[model samples]
Target: MVRKHERLATAWAAGVAGVVFALLMAAVIVLVRVALPGGADGGDVTTDSGQRSAVRTALALLPFAGIAFLWFMGALREQAGEGEDRFVSTVFLGSGLIFVATLFAAAAAAGSVLGESPQSSDFGRRLTYTLLTTYAMRMAAVFIITTSTIGRRLGVLPRPLVVLGYLSGLALLVMGANVPWSELIFPVWALVLSLNILWGRRPASARPAAPA
Candidate 1:
């Protein structure tokens, strides 16, 4: 059976996810604006000031996705009831935590690349760019896969949404060869998943209501 605290937790998580999705969507807009004006000639793609700024903004936006994923997990856990196994919950939580960590790493790397003497050793440039891009895509993969798994098990998200989640996960997995595509996919999928979580009805708490 679902406990009162568990139900409350799920509702809170969903609310937080909704707010975070808005923030992340805003950040994506800011990033696109910042990145579009400059052509490829200014500097190395990774070290370019405009690109760095965009990456930083994107990184800052990732917490929303993380929060959304966490809330989805919370909802799933509550729905699973007492018979629900803990392994899936742990996987969801673990993946969400790692996703957040990767975002932090991406932010740091972007900052380093954008700092003064912007173009440093080629190795550092490549490393930073790789970290920012690769990790972002990987985190997207983790988010979609884990969430789809949890949603399937708990029957929280709609069927179409779950299918989209799987497709998004597969796209991210293959996105390594297409940087721009990965950038687009991550934010778009995150928004979709966030909306699904936020709009779903919350599981009921066990606590009885006081007399009206």
Candidate 2:
């Protein structure tokens, strides 16, 4: 009974955290994209007060998003228990940490634009874009791919969802830097995965055995 309750709690934690992280991240991405539709080289974002406010809001929400993501990741890992592969788990953990670090770095870079001259603002904006689209999204892709692989190996995710994960990961890997708003894919994937957890769709083998 204790173990069953523990598993239920962990699942709920994973599902709730994932949903929170996804919603926060999606909002941040939308706010940032709307505020900076022209990308780094298109326009001077510092001149517009509205854009600056939007960017500030996005930056403010980023830390909370990162925190929720960490919780989601930890809870998902806990669900894997002793069956998790050491090598894949290492990649999963590394990618997640790197994604958060890069995300923070990008937010910092974006924040610097508010206090800088037009000349330096351009540099900061470019740096922010590079960190977010190129580095952070790449790490996100790796995390998604590794997670899907782990889920498949553990029989925790269905085949359709696994295929979707692979496709989403690949899209982010190849087109994330070039495509505007592509970062939303990560949050969408998280939302889907979280919903699956909440629905309790796992195979019987993946569940804890009853206390005899």
Candidate 3:
């Protein structure tokens, strides 16, 4: 009973961490979006204090978010245990790692814009855009798909959530880089998944019939 209680506590802790990861990452995206100008012209890059502050805050949050994500993954794996489908689990873990890597790459690309001359800001801005909206989102889509697939196979997720994951994954894969702010969906999905798990929506065991 004690071991089971500990496991449950760990699961809840992991769920909270996952939610934190989503929140921090979402905040970073929003802050960076607000700080950057709409026009792609490198000449428009401004090092104003507000934008700089936003970028700095975003940079500071990213490492914590990544660490939380790693913890979330480990906790989720513990929940799945040895019964999980090996192939799907492998893909899920791999895509998650790639997602974090590309996410950091995007942040670094954006950070590089800070020190550059206004003339060079355009190049950095475009690079950051491509890295984040294009590459990072693609990896996120793969992660979502694999996670949804695992959840479906394990019966650990509700049908509506699984369908929502597919839709979100499709948006990331198909409309990615083209749709502004589309990357928010990744964090939003993570929030939903974490909340659902934390709500004690575990797989049920078949109960034997009551005695007559």
Provide the TM-score for each candidate, comma-separated. 0.67, 0.93, 0.88
Task: TM-score winner between 2 and 3, please give it.
Answer: 2
**Candidate 1 local lDDT, 127-207, one digit each (tens):** 544654576567657767776777777676788988988888888777763545355565576666666555554443634
lDDT of every model, 2 decimals: 0.59, 0.92, 0.81
lDDT of 3 at 70: 85
Candidate 3 per-residue lDDT, tens place, 1-212, comes to 99787778777977898899999989988987877756244245455778777778888898888888888887887887777898888988998888888778877877766775775566767877787788888988988888888889889889999999999999999987667788899999999999987876343444444579
Instruction: Give me the candidate number with maximum TM-score.
Output: 2
TM-score of 1: 0.67
lDDT of 2 by residue, 1-212 (tens): 99888988999999999999999999998988888787877588778999899999999999999999999999999998889999999999999999999999999999877865887678878898899889999999999999999999999999999999999999999996699999999999999999999888465888788999
| Candidate 2 error regions (>4 Å) | 201-212
Q: At residue 39, what lDDT does model 3 achieve?
A: 23
Count of clashes, each model: 0, 0, 1
